[model samples]
Target: MLSLTKVCAGYGGFQALFEVSVEVEAGEAVAVIGPNGAGKTTLLRVISKLIGATSGEIRMQGASLARVPAHEVVSRGIAHVPENRRLFPRLTVEENLRMGAFPRAARKRYAERLEFVYGLFPRLEER
Candidate 1:
């Protein structure tokens, strides 16, 4: 339910993205992998509206996202996990995990989500 079409974005005036496009449908997971200077982050920044696109469009649920801000994208159910783990050091493993599902409604489903994450890393369950 997410897609980008020929999206272009950049810092200052020089363009980092050129005609970039991607799509992720409901129940489908898409990954972006590339070397440095591939504009991976820039594309995400454009999709999430963290950075404005110079051209083209990003859409969610068939609605245009033109000129939307970064914070607004979360309402569309787009969660961008950071590159590095950003768990709170002062919190225990469980607490840190809890923080990741900070949305109150999302938190209601945390038990299932926790089990899913833990199953992927059983060692974490032991921790």
Candidate 2:
């Protein structure tokens, strides 16, 4: 589970979130809805560490993520997909997926995970 309390994040002089709080319990589903530029993506970015919370605390399973970096966020079991498809134009589709699976500690299970991904995209399996 992940929890965010009064998260305040923004750039330079502009602000996005204002004392925003959120919670995602394990095996639970949640959805965020808002108008254009309502900090929807920013909320995700903050939790994933892609963007820092100007003020607030983010916790997962009782551990604090105040100092965690962006790339390591995924290793903590949190995956972040930006608003746009962040694909590497120079990399093949397969290579792109590989990049998505970057946790070195997960290498031994890569084959099974690859199969699971392929199951979701049969065309990828064909490739």
Candidate 3:
């Protein structure tokens, strides 16, 4: 589970998010829909620690992420797949997916994770 309470962040003096609060319970699907410049991306960036929140608290499974580095975010079961293409053009789809399991902890459960991924997007596995 993930929780964001009164999170506020911005670049320089431009405050993008103001007291944004969100809670994602286990197995819950929460959609963040907003127009451009609506701070949707900023909220995610703050949660992933890509950018620091000027104010607020972010917790994952009751563990505070105030001091957690961005690189360690994934180890906490929080992955931020940016909305951009960073794939290996020569690699197969499955191979590309496998690249995501590069971390030692993730690699240990590659097959299981792959199954879960494919279950969510069966077309990817078929291709």
Name the best candidate (by lDDT).
Answer: 3
Q: Model 2, 4-89: lDDT tens per residue?
A: 99999998888999999888899798999999999988898888898899998999998899988877788987878664675467
Query: Between 1 and 3, whose TM-score is larger?
Result: 3
Compare the candidates by TM-score and give the number of the best one. 3
Per-candidate TM-score against the hidden true structure: 0.82, 0.76, 0.88
Candidate 2, residue 84: how far the Cα is off, in Å:
3.9
lDDT of 3 by residue, 22-114 (tens): 999999989999999999999989988999999999999989999999999978777677666664678899998887787788899999989
Off by over 4 Å in 2: 27-31, 79-87
Candidate 1 residues lying further than 4 Å off, grouped into runs, are 84-90
Q: Model-by-model lDDT, in order? A: 0.81, 0.84, 0.90
Query: What's the true lDDT of residue 4 in model 2?
Result: 93
- lDDT of prediction 3: 0.90
Ranking by lDDT: 3, 2, 1
Q: What is the lDDT of residue 19 in candidate 1?
A: 88
Model 3 steric clash pairs: none
* Model 3 regions lying over 4 Å from their true place: 85-91
How do these models rank on TM-score, best leading? 3, 1, 2
